[model samples]
Target: MKPILLDVPLQLETDRLFLRAPLQAGDGDVVYEAIRDSINELKQWLSLFQTIPTVEETEIILRNAHIDFLKRESFRYLIFHKDTNEFIGTASLHAINWKVSKCEIGYWINTQFSGKGYMTEAVRELINLGFQQLRFRRIGIRCESTNLSSRSIAEKLGFKLEGTLRNDDLSADGSKLTDICIYSIIM
Candidate 1:
């Protein structure tokens, strides 16, 4: 089946959070704020946040993300608090291979929300969406081996450590080589 014909939900919910595609025009403001507040921590793992982005740049990124979501090229959901409607972070099912029925999950949380298990819960929902709703045969999470927080999410959710690739990629800042840990769960 063509991925474009698939009916993906615009929003998904958990007890404390809601995940939605970046569809609204002003969505970037909140996302930008989160990025600004989390930049110090985010820069360690995510290259995109190596420098703080202006609100306009962030808005453009989100707008493009909306287009990607519609095209089924990738699904980037902005995570938010359920009751307060506060933006918390983002979780994405990306690097999709439709014929292989697989994709990778990528995520980050605002520093203020870290260590609270919000990211774990949000990722758990994405896993369910991939296997059950998207019918993906395999979903993987690949992160820097030093990123214990990310590795923990995959482990806590029962993803197996498929392998670790030594010196697999450059660090987010391109300063040094880093090992990559690959984790996966099959439906």
Candidate 2:
């Protein structure tokens, strides 16, 4: 069956968060601002933010995300504070393997929202969505071994450590080799 025909929700909510696909046309501006505000911290882990992205570029990305969501190619969600209606971070179910019914999750929080537990809550919801709604057999979180915050989120959510890939990739800055930690929860 074509993935595009798969029925899925565009949004999911928690006590403090509202997670949704980039359906709003103006969401790119908001996402761009969050990236600008969090660039320094984001650059530490994500190679995508090594250079500041223009608003137009961010918008294009968001538009693509919307298209991807419709095609069921990948689901990238924008996180917002429920009460405040503030953008807090980004999360996604990417690296999909439809045949295996699995995907890897990735996330980043706005620097201002760090340590607030919002991301953990958001990711927990994503895991649930993957298993319950998407019928995934496995959901994984892969992070740089040095990123304690990222690793802890997976651990906190009960994802077991599957293995570590030494020298899995380069650091965001391309200055050093980085190890990748693989954690997963299987149904």
Candidate 3:
């Protein structure tokens, strides 16, 4: 089946959050603000946040993400609070391989929204979407070994620790080598 022809949901909901594709022109403003507020923490794990981006740049990046969504190359869901409608963070099913029926899950939360289990809740929804809705055979989560919080989410969600890659990649800031932890759930 063609990935572009797949009937993927643009939005998903949890008890406290909603995850949606970045489709609106002005959506970047909120996302940019979240990034700005969480830049320090984000920079530790995400190379994209190494430098704060302007609103215009964020908008452009989101536009490209929309294009990717349309092509079904990837899905980037912007997380929001259900009642307050505040942007929490983003969770993505990327590095997809439709033929193999597998993909990787990636996520980050605004510093303000961290430690509330919001990210873990958002990811649980993604896992359901990937397995039950999308019918993926395997879903994987990869994070730097030093990112204990991220590792905890995977562990808490019952994703088995497959292995750890020694000196797998450079840190987000490219300052030094870092180990990569691989976790997965197989359907």
Candidate 4:
């Protein structure tokens, strides 16, 4: 089936959070603020913000993400607190393989929202969406082996650790090589 023909939910509700695709024109600013506030921590893992990005640049990326969502190439959602309507983080069902019904899930939360189990809950919902709603055969998550917090999230969700890719990629600072742990669930 052409993915664009697939019925994708515009929003997903958890107990305290709302997950939705980046469809609003002004949505990028909120995400940019979150990244700005969390850059010290985020830069340790993600190289996407190696340098702080301007609001305009972030908006462009968010706009492109919307296009990708329409094409069903990848699904990037901006997460928000249901009650407060505050942006909490971002997550994506990316690196899709429509034929195999597989996709990789990635996420990052604002530092202030960390340790609250928000991301864990968000990821669980994505897993359900991927397997039951999206009808995917496999869902995988890859993270740096040294990132215990991220690895723990996958374990908590009952995703099995497939293996560690040694020297799989560069460290966040690009100063050295790092190992990556791949975890997956197959339906």
Prediction 3 global C-alpha lDDT: 0.95
Better of 3 and 4 by lDDT: 3
lDDT of 3 by residue, 1-187 (tens): 7778989999999999999999988998999999999999999999999999999999999999999999988899999999999999999999999999999999999999899999999999999999998899999999999999999999999999999999999999999999999999999
Model 2: per-residue Cα lDDT over 20-90, one tens digit each: 99988888889899999999989999998999899899999889988898989899999999999999999
**What is the lDDT for 59 in model 1?**
99
Cα deviation at 146, candidate 4, in Å, is 0.6
Please report, as a residue range, the 10-residue window in candidate 3 with the lowest summed lDDT: 1-10
Higher lDDT: candidate 1 or 2?
A: 1
Q: In candidate 3, how many Å is residue 124 off? A: 0.5
- Model 2 TM-score relative to the real fold: 0.97
How do all models score by TM-score?
0.99, 0.97, 0.98, 0.98
List model 4 lDDT by residue over 104-184, tens digit each: 999999999999999999998898889988999999999999999899999999999999999999998899999999999
Go through the candidates in order and give each one's C-alpha lDDT: 0.95, 0.93, 0.95, 0.93
Residue 80 error, candidate 1, Å? 0.7
Per-residue CA lDDT of model 1 for 1-187, tens digit only, reads 7899999999999989999999998998999999999999999999999999999999999999999999999999999999898899999999999999999999999999889899999999999899999999999999999999999999999999999999999999999999999999998
Q: Cα deviation in Å at residue 37, candidate 2?
A: 1.1
In the predicted model 3, the residue pairs found to clash are: none
Off by over 4 Å in 3: none
